[model samples]
Every structure is written in C-alpha cells, then in structure tokens.
Target: MAKITASVYTSHVPAIGAAIDLGKTQEPYWQPLFAGYDFSKEWEKAQKPDVVFLVFNDHATAFSLDMIPTFAIGTAAEYQPADEGWGPRPVPAVHGHPALAAHIAQSVIQDDFDLTIVNKMDVDHGLTVPLSLMFGQPPQSDYRWPCKVIPFAVNVVQYPVPSGNRCFQLGKAIRKAIESFDEDLNVQIWGTGGMSHQLQGPRAGLINKEWDNRFLDRLIAEPAELAKVPHIEYVREAGSEGIELVMWLIARGAMADVAGGPAPKVVYRFFHVPASNTAVGHLILENQPA
Candidate 1:
C-alpha cells in the first residue's frame, strides 16, 4: 500500500522564485536565504519521493471572490504555471498522478472532509515556488518537474478559512487514505507558506522572528499542542498573512506520531527572514522506519 514517507514544510514566496529564475540568488541580499536551503536541496536529492502531496493556499489566483472551496485537490494529469499579474515564471509544467489523486479524493471525501476535485487549473507560485526550491530548475532541453505532484489547495484568502485543528484532523484523514490505497508508492506531504510577515496596509513588511522560531520549535516537538493554536493568534501575533501557518498543520498531521506510528526524524530545519516580504521557514521530517 502507498505510504507517506516524509513531510516537508516551507515558505513559498514569489520573489524567491524570481530570484532563482533570474540567476540573482548569488546576490548579497539573497545569498543567505538561498544558502539556508542548500541542505534541503541535497537532502531531497538523496532521498527523493515518487510523488509530493503539496499543501498550499491559493493567493487569489485560481479562486476569486466569486468562488472559493475551503479545500481543493487537483486530480488533473497536468497543471500549468499561472500568470499572477506579472508574467508566468519559466518553470516546467507540473505532472500530476491522476489515479492516486482521484483515489485520495474519494477516500478523503468518504472520511467526511468536503473537497473540490479540480481537473484543470493554472497553478500559481504558491504551488510552483515550493517545487522550484526542492527540485531546483529543470534542464533547458527538457523542462519537467522531477516527481509527480498532487496539489492540495486550502482557502486561506477567505475570511472563514479552516481552523488549525480542522486542518490537523483533515491531515490525519489524508494519512489514513494514503495507507489504504493499493499502490506501494513513496509520498511526501509538503506544507508551504508562512513563517510570519504581513504584506498589506501599514503593517506590510512585518517579521516576527521570535514568534516564527517558537512556532518551529513547537511544530517539531509538540505538533498536537501546536495544532490547538487559534486563527486569531496567528493573525494578531504573526501578522495577517501569518494565518497561512495553519496549512502546516495539515502536513504535520500526516506525520508518524500523529498516526501512532514511529516518531519522525527531523532531517532538516531552516528559518530565514526577509525573503521578499515574508519570513522563510523550511523543514524535512522523515518517518522512522518501523
């Protein structure tokens, strides 16, 4: 049966993607931020998974004010990069695992978590930026992401977004769904976005390094307790966009400890500030072999 071998968490900032694409990563301002991920890229190369179940929020790219699903899963064979006001990034198209995705949708919905199954949609930096960070840029001759991806988008833009507790529970259901699948595949669940930075009004460019680090510590040692954090705290303490941190619970929920399996090994952990207007955080946790 399919298994979730690991879970990755990171911030998906569009400027980071642009820096990499523009070959500006070596610049003094951006060097440290990219340097922090050097270990993650090497670690990912050493232990690659067949598919990545990426969890992120749509920054008003796919869903607008007119339509918003609290949770959506992509079951399409392919997804294209979106043009979010600025031109689209020159990234490889994302290949999706339709069979596995469809199965997950069915199982998750049966588990009572309502999800909108999307067959076609343009993926924004919220999705693509994370892939770029992990897999790096594909060769110019053949541009394609290294592994199949199943995009799971949460509605963080809307006011009544899913709570941290709800996201955590849903992640457990996802873990159950993956284990019940018949295929024997290696999978990684990635939670992207937020370390704490707000990008709006007078509060723009706010960074709470202390709060972000504390969050990382709790997320590593006591996610169950951390999952209890309410949305208002994330907004008031971390900043408005900081509410995006709730998505991390979904990936953390799929970890081994939450499933009564072995404790997860923290393979890699990183935190950096001022990646664009957001604080960047990255983690790689692998399930200890049973």
Candidate 2:
C-alpha cells in the first residue's frame, strides 16, 4: 500500500511569486517572509514524494461563482496554467497522477462523498504559488516543475462553502482512498490557505497575527478542538468570509491517521504577517507518532 509520507500547509500568495521573480522577496519586508520557507524547501527535496495532492481554492479563475463544485479533484494527465485577470504567470504545466487520482475518486464515492472530477483543467496561482515556494522553478536550465501534482480544488471563495466537520470527514475518506492504492509510491497531501485576513470590500487589509499563530498551534496539538469551530464563527471572528481555514481541516483530517493515534508530529510551523491581506502560515505534519 502507498503511504502518505508528509502533509504540508502553506499560503498561496501570488504576490510572493511575483516578489521572487521581480527580486522583491529580498526586500526589507519580504526577505524574512521568504526566508521562513527555506527549511520547507529542504524538507520537500529530502522527501521528494512521487505525487503531491494539493488542496486549494481557485481565485475566481478556474471556476467562477457561476458553477462551483464543493470538492473537485483533477483526474487528468496534465493541467495548464490558468489565465487570471492580469495574465497567466509563466510556469510549466502541472502534471497529474491519474491512476491515483482515479483511485481517490472511487474511494470517496464508495465512502459516500460526492466529488467532481476534472479531466482537463487549468491551475491558477492558488496551486502554483505553493509549488513555487516549496519547489523552485522546474530548474534554471529547464522550465518544468520538479514534481507531479494532483489538484484538488475547494470552493471556499463562494458562500455556503463546505463545513469544517465536512472537510474533516472528507480528509478521512481521502486517507482511506490513498491507503487502498495497490501501488508502491510516496504520496503527500497539501491543504493551502488562511491564517486570517480578509480580501474584499472595506475589510481588504485585515490582519490578526495573534489569532493566526494560535490557530497554527492549536491545529497541530488539538485539531478536534479547531474542528469544532463553525464556518459562520470563523467568518465573524477571523474576518468576513475568512472561514476558509476549514479547508486546512481537510488536510489535517487526512494526516490524522485515525486508525492509530492521538496526534501527528508537527515538523515545521511558520507564520508571517501581511502576505497580501492574509497572514501567511505554513505547517508540515507527519502522520507517524513523534
């Protein structure tokens, strides 16, 4: 059976990549921000999982408010970069693990969780930024990503999003799906978004560094506690519609390893202020006991 080697959490701030490309990550405010991810870069290289199943919310790029899937999984052979309002960020097309993704789809279905499968889709910065942060560009000499990615899009942008408990349950289903895979491959799942901050209307620049850090701390040691938080409360407390942190629960749920344990080992935790109307928080968890 395939094992989930690691679970990581990172903020998908498009400006960060733009900062790196424009030589702004080294700027006084951004230098330390990027520095925080140095260890994550090292860890990813060391683990080098065969496939990364990423969970992120599209920024009205791939799925607009018109039609949205609660949970969408990419079962395609490849995914191209999406064209956001400004333009597409120059990046290599994302490669997918169709066999595994298909297996996950079947597992979720059997487990009674309806999922939307994308055979052909374009990934926006929400997926690519984390990739760029965790793994640098394909290579200086080549223009491709170092690893293959399976995109799992969540609909947190639109209202009536999935509940925290629902996201958590889905994670359990994902773990079962992955464990049933009859292959020998190292797989990693990532849940991206939030710490706290808002990005719409008058609340555009909200920042709660304290709450963000506390959320990270509790997420590692006391997930069930965090899981109890309702979506409306998250929006009210975190910010207007800032409840997207629920998606992180899905990632956390998958890492829970329910058959075994009490808590997962948190290898790394990072929190940064002001990553464009959001507090950039990053975490890495191992399913095995510490």
Candidate 3:
C-alpha cells in the first residue's frame, strides 16, 4: 500500500497571481499575503510527493449555477484553463493522475459517497491560483508541474452546499481511498478557500483578520475540534455565504488517523487580508513522522 505523506491548504485568490506577475509581492500589503508561504515552498520541494489530491471549490466556472454536485472528482487525462470573464490565465493545462483518481473513484463508491466524475472540464482561479503560487505555470515541453494531480472539487457557491461535518467525513473517506490504492505512490491532499470576506453586494470587502488567524492556529493542532463548528455559525459570523470554510474540514479530516489523534501542525501559514472579495489564508500541514 502507498503511504500518504503530506496535506497542504491554500487560498486561491486570482489577484495574488496578478500580484506575483506584476512583482508586487515585495509591497508591504502584498508582501504579508505571500509571506506565510516562505517555508511551504521549501517543504514541497523537499517532500516532492508523487500526486496532489487538491480539494477546491469551482467558482461557477465548470458547473454553472444550473446544476452542482456537492463533491466532484476529475478522472480525466487533462483539464483545460477556464475563462473567468476577463480571459484565461495563460498557464499550462492541469494533468490528472488517472490511475490514482480511478482508484479513489472506486474506493469512494465502496465507501458510499456518491461522486460525479468529470472527464472533460476547465478549472478557474480556485485551482490554478494555488498551482501558480506553489508550482508556477507548468514548465516547457511534455513534462510539466512538479507532480501530477487528482482534483476533487467541492461546490460551495450555491445554497444547500455540503455541511462542515459532511465535508469532514468525505475527507476521512478520501484517506481510506488513497491508502487502499495498490500503487506505491506518495500523495498529498490540499483543501482550499476561506478565512472570511464576502464577494457579493454590501457584504463585500469585509475583513476579519483576527478570526482568520485564530482559525488557522486551531486548524493545524486541533482540526477534529474545529470540524465540529456548525455551518450556520460559519455563515452568520464568517459572513453570509462565507461558510465555505467548511470545505477545509475535508482537508482536515483526511489528516485524522483511524485511532483518533490531533492532526498535524501548520508547518507553513500565510494570511493576506482583502484579496479581492475574500481574505487569502494559505496553510500547509503534513503528518508528523511516527
């Protein structure tokens, strides 16, 4: 059986990508936004996991508001770049780990979590921003990106989204799916989104840095406890429709052991207030060696 090595969390704010491209990372405001990643960049380079199972939500890019699946897995060979109104963020297309993804699909089925498999689709800033932050645009030629990916997109945009506990359960199930894989490959699961701030109407530009930092501190050391926070509270206090942090529970749940213990610590954490309509909270957690 393959061993699961690391799990990382990232906030995908498209503006951050623009900041990096425009060399604004050194600016006082933008500097702190990317500052938390200093250690994460090094950790990823060292671990060099074979596959990254990214847990992110689609921003009405692939699955329109018409129909949305609570949880969707990409089993395709490749994913295209999505055009988020302005234009496509010129970057190499994302490559998928089909073998591992197929294994996850089967395992998840056996575990009784209904999933929608996407063979062909495009991903927006939700997935690419993190890719650019961590891996940059894929390198030239046939080989690109430091590792392959299995994108597990959660739908958090529409109402009636999955609950925090439900997302956490999915994460636990995902770990089982990965561990049961016959192949001997190193894997990392990433949960993206949230720290507070709303994108719509009057609630826009809301910043709750204090709450964001507190959430980060707890997420690393006591995720199981964090997972218990109710969804209604997330939306109410975090901001209307800002309850998307629940998706992070899925990433946190994947780190929990069957015997039940504290998950891992945040080896690297970055927080940038006011990334467009949201606060960018990026974190990376890896299981401590036994």
lDDT (Cα, 0-100) at 223 in candidate 3? 69
The TM-scores, one per candidate, come to 0.98, 0.95, 0.92
| Global lDDT scores for all candidate models | 0.91, 0.84, 0.79
Pick the TM-score winner: 1
Tell me the tens digit of each residue's lDDT in model 3 across 1-290. Answer: 76667777777777887787577888987776676676677677788889889888898889998889889999998888789897787777788999889989999888999999888889888888887777654556744678888888998888888877788888888998888888889888888877686767776667777877888887776667877787776765677645768878887788845327455655776777676677878877767655
* 92 Cα displacement, candidate 3 (Å): 1.0
lDDT of model 3, residue 26: 86
**Candidate 1 C-alpha lDDT tens digits along 219-241:** 88999999999989998889999
Worst 10 residues of 3 by lDDT: 256-265
Off by over 4 Å in 3: 138-143, 256-263
Instruction: List residue ranges in candidate 1 displaced over 4 A.
Output: none
lDDT of 3: 0.79
RMSD of 2: 1.6
Kindly list the per-residue Cα lDDT of model 2 for residues 17-90, writing each as its tens digit. Answer: 68866768878889888999999999888998888989998888778888999999999999988888767777
Sort by TM-score, best first: what order?
Answer: 1, 2, 3
Better of 2 and 3 by lDDT: 2
